[model samples]
Target chain A: MSEKRIEISQLGEFGLIDRINRQFTLKNESSLKGIGDDAAVIQASGDECMLVSTDMLVEGIHFDLSYVPIQHLGYKAVAVNVSDIAAMNGKAEQITVSIALSNRFSVEAVDALYQGIKTACENYNVDLVGGDTTSSAAGLVISITVLGRAPKSKIVYRKGAQVNDIICVTGDLGAAFMGLQVLEREKQVFMADPGMQPSLEKYEYMVGRQLKPEARTDIVFDLEEAGVKPTSMIDVSDGLVSELFHLSRHSEVGIRIYEDKVPIDHMTFETAVEFKLDPITCALNGGEDYELLFTIRQEDQEKIKKHPDIHMIGYVHDRKNERVMITKQGNTVPLRAQGWDHFTE
Target chain B: MSEKRIEISQLGEFGLIDRINRQFTLKNESSLKGIGDDAAVIQASGDECMLVSTDMLVEGIHFDLSYVPIQHLGYKAVAVNVSDIAAMNGKAEQITVSIALSNRFSVEAVDALYQGIKTACENYNVDLVGGDTTSSAAGLVISITVLGRAPKSKIVYRKGAQVNDIICVTGDLGAAFMGLQVLEREKQVFMADPGMQPSLEKYEYMVGRQLKPEARTDIVFDLEEAGVKPTSMIDVSDGLVSELFHLSRHSEVGIRIYEDKVPIDHMTFETAVEFKLDPITCALNGGEDYELLFTIRQEDQEKIKKHPDIHMIGYVHDRKNERVMITKQGNTVPLRAQGWDHFTE
Candidate 1:
């Protein structure tokens, strides 16, 4: 009872992970790489490597069942875990999804959830290998572990980025953030007036981004086909600036991205304006857009220079801790990341 | 909403798994086997194969924080997952433990939980490769996925037990169930009078078994050393009779286990009597023992006959649907499995 008490918020989520992960070292030889990557890398047979990643989504903290459909929840859960494997430039082959839910969820509800999971498996060409379902004392919890593989030569790590490498991102950023905003606004309106019906037709694009995000596995295949392997890669689940910080720290290089070059969907920008928020800030700091961010060597830039889905945003610098963004009016600003800190009150 | 109100309890856990797993087929060549086992089998190179399994433990549903220490909960969680690998006759190499917890847990509490996880990792020689830690809106949720490997020749499944195979079990049975009964009794007493000190001196063994159940990985090593391969193997988590039912159903063989041969610690028997419960019934149907149950070919039984820990219980029979138990009094009774159905109110 007299033991010391420390608030988890004092050491945020990242700090907490660092503290815990520091105590353990990779002991198994097959464990090629452990904590601190999008996915752990393992030595597989045939001189290939495997990628393993797991994510747990809690109902109330991660999603509100009242607004988010169970089907989309199931799909998003699979997509985010697959995004981790894709971040390692690997194709996810199998996934195990375990869920814990209370009796409030019916058999039909579970069917709807699995239908979406099956849909994702078909979409990504992944197989559902195994999972456990147990009763929860409270709200629903879904945890998915994905196993993937790539040839040893094709595998990439966050520490592979180098000076002058092009920093590229797949798909537009901030749309999913804007989508969440619209969903929240609509939920409030509906809550305030119970008899009023919600109209989501106009905001479907943005809402869908938040409800059903997809992993950019196709881009991994495209890069392999084009014979351009990214030097370093990470999934953009924690906002552009936050993931950039990860790549910079691990690769020990600085980065400079132009704000004007940051990709933003038309609807995202429009919604940002309507919400009286800055589109650029949302693109830089809003999370949950499961896009791939990676750096490519200068010589490989011509391989996919005209690829419409890929956007070249910046270049890596030589010095670490010197990340910046050039504004449209020739002003350079230090990029700030207000990433999610769930532990913080 | 009118589609279906079928209760999950109607199908039961195994039936629900059957209903769900029947819809999906393994599409990837690397997926050697999917579902219907303690772990999933995946094709690995070098004449070996890999095993993967997952288990999710919800806080209130799986453990009562008031009586269960967080550290032991963490240790037991990892141990149970490792037991799944051992059930497949494989060595667990890596595990990803993802947890979602609310702010009620402090930094010190999280540290205590990780201390147990780290201890288990060191004890089992399994690497903690990767995991996701997120905030839960309510109670704590821990989901662990383990990856293991074994030579193809050594791998064992539940379907391989043949008629006349000698059934074996590792370690004593039903102590953990007795342990839970002891703990729950002490908890009720303490709750009735908070000032009363819990007299757990005499119940240390049972209490330990309940709080810290160790996986029988040693039996796997012993079997290998003895050059004996179990025709089929499974971990006895949900009571001995339930596991026997699984082995019987999967192997398409009936089972005849002698009640006199079911190993029960003397303390467990006496404690069951103290709790006004039948000792044999407790050994047969009480869950969470985490023992290894298997069937060895009659010729291979001699190799492990003298193994100090392994107990030869009975034999597999030819009649697929006829399972029975021979009591010490020389009477026979049909074996029944009142398995753990968490969905039941």
Candidate 2:
């Protein structure tokens, strides 16, 4: 074999996506948008269109069966896919879930997994459409594709942010990351001493955040009701800083955020300190929070200003590569993203 | 620890699907059909509807990397998903391909896979839409979701076959199964004697059939041109008899076929005989044939009668569960589906 071998780690995930994306050109007129966005937009009706997004969660790579409940895994699978649709400012209506698992999984185990899936379907008002089920060689793999609907007028892309647009994020950040820390710590303790039971009572909030994160679809509805469409939007799945980089690049704008304004739950902050981690760092880099992060036009900021859950953390500016954060002491520091790279890790 | 453990193999794949299907109800108005057809039907526009179908291919469970080229595997993955859309008598326009691979695969391998995916996209005239790329702990897993469009009037389901309807199948069958046999035999031979070079010149047709099965989208075009609508349709992915059983159960009709009329290539027949296997049984129970199987009205038979690739193999009867095949010697035998059950195997 004379072929040159280039390791995938050399390109990394995003670089690899860029390489693949460069090769294909959209041929169908109905395919309004393709690979780059959170969800691909397809023309549906006269003024309405459909949004399609997919996510695959592998067993050992994405979750640990020993610690993560099979049910929560099912629910999280649906939620994360739905979050993609929500990031597009659309309502997810249908999903197809395909699962591949080894024979080690039982019928009762599958039932419990589906139980969580069904619960999520009800909660999100999304219908289960179609999927493939088959056996895997090793552990479980869940891949879900979600379809969403929105009027063409209401659709927002990540490339639409203008100068001086206010950046807003829904709910507190880093709680899910902290929750993961707690779960991992508990698992380690239980593994060290088999007879000692795990005590999760004190970390229930953060633990639940990690186990059963919700897509911020309600925020999409709230913004619509308030007549304030986000200039640009994205779901915070790969850390706040990483997603901000995406918005900045796509929108071709700079970003300025205050570290003091970054939302962090009290429990998350306290736990981060206890774990000898910086709360601000966790809020910026810790991922899987499934929160909506978006930028609104300066004129529309007043519409959602009084909203309890939404926080105004930053603003978009004209300088393209000048992303920075103002510390509590008023020191301007360049913001660097330490996003999760599953491949390299 | 006290929970009852019922193995998944006990229920088989179809039984497990039934159990999962019973627990959910479609609530979205856009969800016209869910979970029961080759593709889920969603109301898109006035009379225009969209079809959604998904399929997942696991490395070891579905294909062996030792013999199968990664590029061909990628093309086969897309083709199978498109075949599902073709089975529904719809034109597939967009697809999302999500792949999970471990570090064992290189950047060059990933590029080869995407190259095949791109070629399929061009061949099918389908747009490459959104998908997830993630790291897996083991072998490669490819999950593809396809979106298609057809007028509601032209859409066909699995439950529309009428009594005495003529069953037509596109292209020849069983070649793919034979191809698998040849590949597996060569693999074993190579394992025993590593220096032996595999000479597959005589088995090219069958080998290609197994490695890169083409979807019968052209047949769908031919049927449209002939102005014929199939009463019920399904893809022959899980053997001809298994698909017949699906149509029978869904349409509440019996199936009767002539074994002599079943199309088998000379190469397939010769190969099956060489392997000491029954050719007719291979045609009956051999899976992975991405051919269209549908029922047409008696009046519409002449429209496609002269089609070179179309074979009139069977007919639908009034009595449910009375499926049988008449052998070349005129002896009737009960038709039973030995469909592929990966879990059980």
- Judging by lDDT against the true structure, name the best candidate: 2
The deviation in Å at residue B61 for candidate 2 is 0.6
Give DockQ per model, in order.
Answer: 0.82, 0.86
Best by DockQ: 2
lDDT of 1 by residue, B105-221 (tens): 898888989999999999999999999888987888899999999987888999999999999998888888999998888889999999989888787887888899998889899
For model 2 chain A, the run of ten residues with the poorest summed lDDT = A1-10
Tens-digit lDDT string for candidate 2 (A69-149): 999999999999999999999999999999999988999889989999998999999999888889998899999999999
At residue A141, what lDDT does model 2 achieve?
95
lDDT of 1 by residue, A249-313 (tens): 99999999998889999989988999999999999988999999999999999998989999999
Q: Candidate 2 i-RMS (Å)?
A: 1.0
Instruction: After superposing candidate 1 on the true structure, give the runs of residues whose Cα lies further than 4 Å from its correct spot.
Output: A1-3
Against the reference, the lDDT scores of all candidates come to: 0.91, 0.94
Clashing pairs in 2: none
